[model samples]
Target: MSSKSSSQFSTFKDCLARRLISTTDLDGPEGSDDPLDEFTSYLASEVWPALPDTLYTASYESLSSDTVLQEMASDPFYISLDAIPIPTSFFDTLTSYTHFEDAHDCIRFLRKVLSDYLTEATAPPPVWKQTRGEKCEICERGWVRLTYHHLIPRSVHGKVLKRKWHTESMLNSVAWLCRPCHSAVHHVASNEDLARYFYTVDLLLERDDIQAWKKYASKQK
Candidate 1:
């Protein structure tokens, strides 16, 4: 029993850590950088153990009932479910609670805090400046048909595992394109190919050459 307890605690910590590091800003000024570390550390040491049985029950209930989550499900960029790790059982339990408003509040807190935790681990900051390209990255199609896409597909890199910070730097390259061009790009590219497409964007951005990007997209088209 003691061994099982220890293992569960360890799993929680790892989950907590992964959640934190994925979203927090590690590069900001002292206060601006991931602000939740202290709270999370405290929770690890004291709070999580002390949390009432009911809150846990309510939490699981709230997650299950959240209709808004489906919007995320619809995204083409979304990946596997484990990235965020909200168990189906927990969601079911969350939906069954009577104090649902309170449960909703708690769930929100956990989601926000955990997301922040994850950001701190995997990303640099909370927001990023958009860099615009005049042509589609997939087709040499010009700005009129261009829109930005995640070179690595944000859904794959961490959509299942959403980090506020990843949203900032991960989309470093924006291929300007119209809707049809964007659809065509995805239709033709394999998952692996899409991953490479982002890598190419990173390479071009590193060199600060838009013309090179245009040439690459032209070839892709």
Candidate 2:
């Protein structure tokens, strides 16, 4: 790539990073919705519009064959979205393509790969034990037929844990709790909030609503 092209790419990356960080900062303690989803939407709506026309002509073959993208997809890392490296060859191939379909395919591939990587990098560790019939961890309800609750909601974190960590069960990343306690958690917070703040039995219990629910649920038979 020419020096000018490299500089443009660098500038784009910087801009993207700034946007992502700003978005993340906006996530208050009460918890926002799925951050990864928000990020992806930003790329599609905001970043795509600002990119050079060449980026819109990129081919699937080029994207699929990009070594860096493949490696990142297989062994994903947790980094600011803007810091992700795009290869010069990938850009070159994109610039050579004439069909919009090619570009669309490349974009889809990139979104899937990046989403998978981010999901894996941010996912919580899974629980391994199969401790059944235990006291509920949250409500301390004895003999209540406990169910495993993912401290981080599974919809947001489970994909990564399953893909990268080979986590196949709620036991891989959960606290044993009764049905009411488990349901109460989802009722109060979003997946992003659970992943960021309530990703532990103690933390979940610390929530005023959760605490109130625990007190109420514990009184049941």
Q: Judged by lDDT, which candidate is best?
A: 2
Candidate 2 lDDT score relative to the true structure: 0.53
- List candidate 1 segments past 4 Å from native: 1-129, 159-168, 171-173, 196-198, 201-221
Tell me the TM-score of model 2. 0.37
1-221 per-residue lDDT for model 1 (tens digits): 25434544554455555554564332322464544554344445443444322222222223345433222223312322334444443434333322334445435535554443322332332332255556554445663555666555655665422533222344443445556556644665654446554345434344423444445556553
RMSD of 2: 15.8
lDDT per model vs. reference: 0.43, 0.53
RMSD score of candidate 1 (Å): 15.7
Best by TM-score: 2
Task: Name the TM-score of candidate 1.
Answer: 0.26
Q: List the candidate 2 regions with Cα displacement exceeding 4 Å.
A: 1-127, 131-133, 158-171
Question: Model 2: per-residue lDDT, tens digit, 7-48?
Answer: 434444444444445433333213447643444344434444
Name the 10 consecutive residues with the lowest summed lDDT in model 2.
91-100
Q: What TM-score would every model get versus the actual structure?
A: 0.26, 0.37
